[model samples]
Target: MADIQRLSLNQATVQNWSVKEAVDGCVRHGIPSIALWRHKIHEAGLQQSAQHVRDAGLHVSSVCRGGMFVAPSAAERKERIMDNFRAVEEAKELNADSLVMVVGASTEVPIADARQMVADGLAELVPYAREQGVKIGLEPLHPMYAGDRSVLNTIDQSLAMAAPYAADEVGLILDVFHIWWDPTVFEQIQRAAGRIFGFHACDWLVPLPDTLLGRGVMGDGVIDNHALRLAVDAAGYNGPIEVEIFNQALWDTPGDDVLNKVVERFTALV
Candidate 1:
């Protein structure tokens, strides 16, 4: 294992783990950080879950999501914004390093328009998040998901839109699974600089099936995760290395075992 700090688990990677189990899993593996989805804390309730993590002496890297900003009705948009407010509150509750935002896309609207909707939602949430002392980490899903998952689809593109809301309060998550093939990835890492709040790792399989679940385990696919982590480190990011693989095979296993393997691989790779 590398002496440098390594291996944080994003809750989705071990979705089968309860919030309690996940905290202990990380503690047992000697991982220093973690990121979580709202669903987990909501299931466990914020206070109890947050206490367990703190008691275990672990760092909460970021909360998994916010920013489903595209909607047909004003009411729906308001609801999404409120949900983000609650997510930021959860970040506060857990003392997370940041709150991860997945700015959603609307196929019915033009990509540009959808992105603007995201900007609007962030404008509304960023101030409150800043007040609560939670940094917003925007994750740019790959261009393949621009139609359904996120309008902010590239590192440079996401940073361009997200930079305005960013103070000490908000930043970006650079994920190799999402952006490894991006032509500008090298430069954008430099551009993101101090603003890169988190780093996620996984591999992209060649014959990608289902467009979503084809995420390969760390060494199983073609991605250069080592190079990606090095780029993140070079960009002046000395924070958590979050493992965020959304693969079907791993999901079928017990979450504890999955986490153990992830720590094992992350130690060897990064």
Candidate 2:
């Protein structure tokens, strides 16, 4: 059985629940940790969200998202960077383990230029995050999202992007949904070692219902979540194993029921 103590309820899995509700769900379901999204945090009021998690004694595994560096103009890029500065502040306020960064994709610029922009953005943001005592988790989206969501589309790419920074300052957030198909994923996971800040689990549906919102719960699809979990464990990431599904069907279900399913599938498959 997977360790129940290590399961973290990423708020995206229960999209309908408010921050306080998510925290309460964690308390009721015995989930020890949570990964929060910024919109939900803002909706619940940042201080209130922090206080709720604090009072419930739940660990904040990570704060969802603080990147999107690609832009057509310098002013727009600067705006995004400033927003990341605010994200760092938010992460510090919640005492989160890291600030998850879904680095932006190429806009009108060349793909190579977009990548350089991501590198430069990280160069600036990492120091600020470090100063705030927060870690930056560079999350590589699936390659399909490379044109719209993120330029960093593989574990190797994310690791390369993180190479210039100390492991604690910047690291990789490895998601099974995004990276399970890679031929060298296991080798990359081993290479990540001390540089993996978070581990996310979700299955990839065979038919792929929706590119962005079609992720399956741990066992509902083709990925060998257990093997991946073992690989991450072998890679020395002994922290929370977050369930971060993005399926509309799951979101439409009652939040408690979804949590129940998550616990069941995670225990059996992950």
Candidate 3:
């Protein structure tokens, strides 16, 4: 059996639940860790959110995000950088493992220009994040989301973006839902090795749901969870395997039930 201690329930899996409720549910379910979203933390107030999680004796595996460097103007890029600085501070306060990043897209500008913006933004942000004792996790969203959600759309691309910095300062987030389709995934996982900062698991549904909200639970879709887990383990990552799904049906279900299914599926597959 996979160690239950290595499984974390990402808050987005149960979006309606408050931070306190998610923490309580994790404690009740014998889940040792959680991945929090910034909006949820804001709703509870940062200090209160940190205290609540600490008081409950739960480990924060990671904080939702700290990216989006693609902006229209210099002034706007600075604003995004400042927001990322705050995210790093919040992660420090929460004692999180890392701050996840979805480097932004280029709808109007050239893709290369957008990528340059991300690189430039991280050049400044990584140093500050390092000073604050927070690691930056560069998550490459799927190509389907490349147009609007993220320009960083592959494990190798994220790794390349993080290459200029030390492994401790910048790393990659491997999500099955996003990278499973890549033929070079395992090879890239090997290359990532110690720089693998976070691991997220969610299967991709077939008939490919028209909406991005159609993620499937583990074992319910086409991903080879066992292979991916083995590859990540072989690449020297033993961190929490976070279950981050965006299914509307799962969100509508009772939070406890969603968590139960997550645990059950995670245990069976990963």
Candidate 4:
């Protein structure tokens, strides 16, 4: 049987829900885990937010990011590195499994150059992350998002970059929504193998909106969620199936309604 207990509540799902409210909702629904974002922690106060999640008896699968490793100047790159230090501290406080890394967008330099910068940043940050007891999960954004979001746009490419990092302590964050459209999903999954960390999920619409928002519910989209989950599980990642939808319309609705649908959809399909 699929472990429904592995389902996680990613904070972006409830843009309207407060930290306490979201955690409480998870507690109510018995959603075993969650993935948190830095902005949300700031809003609730980190201590309060961490405590809320801990109090609800929920496992924090990951802290949803710290990397933007590409910048124009040395100063800017260093600033990003320093920022990740703070993210590491936050992750340590919550005892989260990993710190998700979105290896930045392309700059005036070049996507290839930006990618090198990401590699350089990880070379330094990975050791720091290990020392701080925080694993970094490098997530490859979709190709469409490569220009403004991430240069690392495929699982195979992500793993190739991640290979130099610590295998046990530094890894990849596999979100099916971003990479499902790729031609080599399964091959990458097989390549990723043990390096796979958190397996995030969300349905992708055919006519995706203008890079802003437009996500379909689990079954509403064209992605085969079962196949996605099967690949992750087959790769030996028996962790939370963290849901990370970025739908503007869904965010506008009440969290209860949103979560009710999410839990139902994930249960029935993903």
The TM-scores of all predictions, comma-separated, are 0.95, 0.99, 0.98, 0.97
**Candidate 1 has what TM-score?**
0.95
Per-residue lDDT of candidate 1, residues 86-143 (tens digit): 9989999999888898898776778778878988888899889988988898888988
Q: Over 4 Å off in model 4, which ranges?
A: none
Global fold similarity of model 3 (TM-score)? 0.98
Model 3 residue 210 lDDT score: 52
Compared with the true structure, all predictions reach lDDT values of: 0.84, 0.94, 0.92, 0.86
Question: Best TM-score goes to which candidate?
Answer: 2
Give candidate 2's whole-model lDDT.
0.94
Q: What is the lDDT of residue 157 in candidate 4?
A: 88
lDDT of 4 by residue, 88-138 (tens): 989888889999999887557598899999999988788888898898999
Which candidate model has the greater lDDT, 1 or 2? 2
For lDDT, candidate 2 versus 4, the one ahead is: 2
lDDT of 2 by residue, 29-123 (tens): 99999999999999999999999999999999999999999998999999999999999999999999999999897659778999999999998
- Model 1 clash count equals 0
List ranges where model 3 is wrong by over 4 Å.
none
Give the winner by lDDT: 2
Candidate 1: misplaced stretches above 4 Å?
1-4
